[model samples]
Target: MTNNKTILVVGGTGMLGKPVAQQLKVDGFNVRLLARNPEKAQKLLGDGFEIIKGDVDDPAALRSALTGVDGVHISLKGGPTEADFDHMDHIATRDIAQAAKELGVGRVTILSAYAVSEEKADTPESRSKLKGEAALKSSGVPYTIFRASWFMETLPMFVQGKSISLIGNQIHPLHWIAAEDYARMVSKSYQTDETLNKELYIFGPEAFTMGEAMKIYAEYAGVKVAPISIQMLAVLGALTFNTEWKGMAVLMKHYENWGEDGSPDEANHLLGAPATTLKEWCNKRYSQPVNS
Candidate 1:
């Protein structure tokens, strides 16, 4: 149960998880990554990292993965939320916490979002993730919750080919952070014990309204897009499960009117730099090809 390798990365194959695991190894921590699909994990494998298949709900496998892990980094996302209110999101927290405790793991850092208790947990993913945080709090593992803002990379989806939805007049001062900045902070959080047992809000260096974000996208991608509000029954359907980014009710509640409150002290303190805004990230996203 003890070895030089002492970090378990759940969902290491994900866009964020892959970089996080890689950064951990570079920092001289022995890292093990758990993935359900070895093939996906294989594509993202970094030097000196180990991959194991895992199901978060399975108590035994979760415990096995935690063996000798000084802490756990959970990038685990998705769950059975079809009419069940994020079945895995809420349940997996308890399961993960139990496994970590059983394996004697002390610290856990999991990807969380800007979920207020009042926010809409109407879907399986949202509700489940919310519950998972509560479970971790009661699970007895010291934890750092990264209540991250929306990722700038997901902006393309909002365009929807040539058209885009302009809800709230595109005037909502939304906040987003580049995945790279978040990954870097996650690395710093792991190296610094000061972050242990605290939940932090992370966002970009500047707050850009939805309209501004779209303007950046249209300009950078060199595509023409206009804002139109299609407030119909279809919008309601869109809200149920968002195929496009704006459709999600949570996004509407948390973001569309999210406001420009400015950056938190910790956003500058722990990360040592503010998050990269949508405009800044657009430069990174379009200055080169995705494969590059």
Candidate 2:
């Protein structure tokens, strides 16, 4: 494996992907984004990096993206059905892995969720992520898979009419990491040999229950805090049955049965730095003007 400074980041235009690409560029790597709109990506990334016009699902596009790229970073947002997961998360990642391997790319890193390994509570999203991880592993390409906890950025979206929806009444330890901190971890993973062939369960420096987290956010946003009961959650689940809503319903059911809980000690030890705390992230993010 010869050293090539160029790295290709799939899904680089997404919420999590944007920060990873930015950090890689700042770290002096020749960062290239495989996006549908190269012009838009170039505009977002400024003049520092390149953007290859392509879709991850297109084999030809992936092959072109792999050319002259040393390493590859993959992160995908989940879709609703099994077919959606199959095409986007599983099949797309497999294509990227296969292309990167054939092209002699040195490393491949995947951003996955912490609960993907729980077979008892598997959803289409989790199953798809596992497939993606397996694809990279089976390709014989050195890989790093990050199973991260919830993103702190998603908290605001749950705020509706002064109430935060809860899957259940039980309070569970939720280890929430900021997208920026996660991106930093991903960039660092690409820089060292230490993370090769590793499946890391990464998380935030702090843990909070759903109520505790929502209360903090409500206070910051100057809104009264209240939790939607399990009965109401059931009603909402029944009312909205589309792909996105259906997926959330399934996940919420899983959380009701099992809890979102973890410790970041090992991940922090490996990364050599602590992640941003929930309070810190909320304060910083909320202080700024909310995105339209």
Candidate 3:
């Protein structure tokens, strides 16, 4: 039972976006991707998707990719700089919304952080995301904004070779969701009009603090968990000009300041709750034999 609807996925080659694109294909939608590197996307996605060579920065590219698509799913991420966030998260999103509106696209779905709100839009990324959400809302295109919790997939990022560094006093409990579950929900959103023009909060089955989550990951990966202060990370980032370090520091601080907010009741009731646990995700992720 294949649906004839074509869905264009922006950021289809990314960590989260990849799964969403895959799930959309699995659910029988005619999947398309607007990729900056067509060859890379073809390599990553292989055989099924219609890969259009384009970048989000190009309005013409956006318009071209959006043409004739029934729905578009945006899963973009920006950098360690305010300018980067403004350009990618805010401006690019605005451009896409405008193009979708003009092309008469059926629906637009986007992934957003759980804590992103106008009042808590202090950070550059948060502010930009808020603005982007506003852009889609004002564009008169049917949109679904998924405010998602922390992903279990991000745990591997903390591992530096043999050790895992836990940054900041991240005591906030987060409903760490899995990319696979989130992807399924995103695909499901396009199936029904009930999800259109709505903002949904996506949370996992269990809640765990950053430390607790890392502990689980550390044990599974056979690595030691070490604490790193946020200030120290910031200093290290400044000294080395490491954008990833700086970005992590900023993100940890943001989460520490404003923990996960919003209820996942609506999303759960509508699209079914996320069933994957961190331990379960880790087991599957690390199922392959590793060198000791």
The TM-score leader among the candidates is 3
Against the reference, the lDDT scores of all candidates come to 0.69, 0.77, 0.91
C-alpha TM-score for every candidate: 0.82, 0.89, 0.97
> Which number leads on lDDT?
3
Question: Candidate 3 residues 113-185, lDDT tens each?
Answer: 9878877887889989999999989999999999999998888888998888999999999999999999999
Cα deviation of 141 in candidate 2 (Å)? 0.9
Which pairs, if any, clash in model 3?
none
lDDT of 2 by residue, 214-234 (tens): 777776776656655555655
Worst 10-residue lDDT window for candidate 1 reads 79-88
Each candidate's clash count: 5, 0, 0
Error of 1 at 101 (Å): 1.7
Of 2 and 3, the candidate ranking higher by lDDT:
3
